[model samples]
Target: MGFFDRIFGRRSAGIDDPEQLRRQLFDAAARGDLSRLAGLCRANRQAVETHFPAWQKVPEHLRSDPAAMQSHVQVLVAIAQVFAQQLGDASLFQRLMGTPRDNPLMRWQDALRQAQERIDALEFTAARELLTGVLSEAEGLQGSGVDELLPITLGRIGECHFESGEAEQALPYMQQALALCEQAGDADGVRIYLGNLFEVHRWLEQREPAAACARRLAEMIADPTAKRQRLRQAERVAAGEPRNRVLAVIDGASYELDELPPLAAGHVRFMFERDRITLRRATAANEAGEACGGEGEYAEALAHFERAATADRHDPHCRYQAAFTLLHLRRYAEAESAYAEVERLAPGWFHCRADRWLAGRLAAGDVEHDVFLAVHALQDGPMAPDEKLDLAEKTLTRAPRLALLHLLRGTQLARLGREAEAVAAFRDGLAGDGEPDVRSRLLVELATHCDGPQERAALLRDAQAPAGNLVAAATAQLLARGSAN
Candidate 1:
């Protein structure tokens, strides 16, 4: 019932209960909470003596279990030793774990401190010798509390190599350290080491891996501003500048092109690969491509679009618009190939090319050319009036505010001899706030389907002002109608 009674296994079946207390101490140590851990160690001081022997009795196989109270107490003691070393007290580990200060654990603790001092003194050779010795011992102590020392030792060895300008040699050790840090659930360690890894990858000219690190950090970090900043930074790394300066790997670091190895030089001939990132970026050249294509500079537009496509291979808009430009350039085969790739990537980039071309052809003379977008295709000429009317109605479902579509609908109905329906379609076109030119055309058409002479004349009067050709056409129609009456 009491804490000590539960910890000493008085009930034997209650061995699992003290594990909760051990876990609390381990958690505090992992969090770098020295004060909290110190308080816990003091409170559980008596429990440690009994738990140490219980831990020693564990089967070697059972010792590997992280939640075993045996390993928890051991790791907790290791953490306390680290604090004691930092605070310049030699008795903390022995006092906490009820052990003499002459054990293998104590030797490793002392070695760790000497290695740090050597590293700070720039004696990398001595530092590495010391750290690696501890690393070997830690690795052999697997399944014990010594598992917690693996990343720490590995990380320091990595730093020695890195600071000595041997990043390539440091790479494997640093990577292992990062993995162990993550496994230990040390958030601060992970965040710090990720940045270090990102820099090393970049220094090695490993853009994809570097971008991967940046992207992962951006997602895991809690700061909202930093997330967006890192995502943008990730994309830039992913979409690295064209023909970036490739460096040569030297004594564990990067060097200039002049020093490139033959194998690395050959690598330059390989096509630059693109990194596929999730965040979308606006390809500035995409807008330039559109403007150039609209101005009839098809070749220039194709080049601009190609630049954007190369910059971001996964951007569907750039790829799709490139295909559109190729078609304008009359490179049909290239256009088809680009479209096929776009289709393979996923097909949401929408441009109503066929509809805009068909509408332009139909309104060839003196009509203000306004581009309209529609999901349904209005077939190239020779379509029957009734078929066209059906297509126009379908297009209106997706683009109800497209006044040009309304005008087209009225024209088709008039051809189909639906007088009243034609009039109503034209009225809808004007009511929808069509451009002045389209509205003028609608008024003239509406008058043709009006039932009475006065209604026809009234509609034509409104049509005569805006469009130059509409004025002549309307005046002539009015005179002819009056004579017929």
Candidate 2:
């Protein structure tokens, strides 16, 4: 069929084949037909790019053109959907932005802009797919354009974490992206990430860093019309110095203590609650602990964190880390105490305390720990529902990296009759590349559901059997149960 024939429903010639095929491919994409989309892109790769182009740069003046607006909107929506579904091939979408035929569209500025829109809408799955594709392509691209995509990708990663409620984990990526923008002399990008950096610091309860970011942002906003140049000129501005002023919540935004911005009473209360935490000031001992930890002084860091915890029993972060550090040091008693304190003070911030506690119990070589492990070893065995919930919540909050956490928490939840939450947790767990220990643990956890030989095979396949023999034995028992069933 000819092009016009396809449009007019006359299939006399083969000329309309490409157009018909393209429409079908798009429809398939809309329905999440991944296999079909992959086949279509493979067969009509050139046609796809020709229709979309390497860079669909919609000029600002085209805003009034309804057709142009519609076209952009449709393509963007489709692209975003593909990313969300985690579809197989996106070569065609990348080609629209001028990527080489063999290379996917990882660093196209136009695509990045659209991806940013999806992020703003809280469509993180789509955002991540888009960013991941961009990063993959970027690994091979040696051009300055790759640099342009770097900060944006980092910012998107931060957004993904933030949307999942892992605000603490989001801080580093935002700061990293801002740093890249500064290095690249991308003034606009710098300004954008600066605002993001500010928000991340606020979320982290790092008042000093947030204040600094805000001050820098104020200095950057010289002339609204000169935004581009203003960004470039940002390097010349003096870095913000820490001020003694400590405002709780002036306006809706977190600000210094001295100046109160005009904010509604309700907003003020919300902001105050979010921003205020009563952790004691970090002393010299605390600094030493952090310094030691950063320098790979594990032993020294453990000591310092313990000392800091000892100095202030009320600090949850300190207590939690001290507990974990003690685990690494094989100090079971101290670790248990620290973990118990954390549970008492901040029950909301759960991150594998039960498992850690179990590890502690086993390490002590006590009969009680052995008995607990033995009971938990059975296939589809009962576990505390509360612990599973805590694990799921923690996994969700820290997604796209802690896959093992997702797997463990999801499996436990599945065993406890929370199927929906279990599915969500497993999906998130599959989202990221987890560490080897986490991966092994997850695999073992998954073995509990597999029947017969497969379960035994999975246990044998574990690359790192967790340092504790009891955990290893429990894993083996679970596999045996799966086999028997």
Please give the CA lDDT of all the candidate structures: 0.61, 0.55
User: How many angstroms is residue 448 displaced in model 2 relative to the true structure, after the best TM-score fit?
Assistant: 69
lDDT of 2 by residue, 354-381 (tens): 5454445446663243233232332223
> Model 2, 363: alpha-carbon shift in Å?
46
Q: List the residue pairs that clash in candidate 1.
A: none
All candidates' TM-scores? 0.35, 0.28
Q: For candidate 1, lDDT tens digit of each residue in 213-315?
A: 9998998968876687688667767777322222334444443333334332222221112223211122567888889977779788888877776655555
* Cα distance off (Å), candidate 1, residue 221: 2.9
lDDT of 1: 0.61
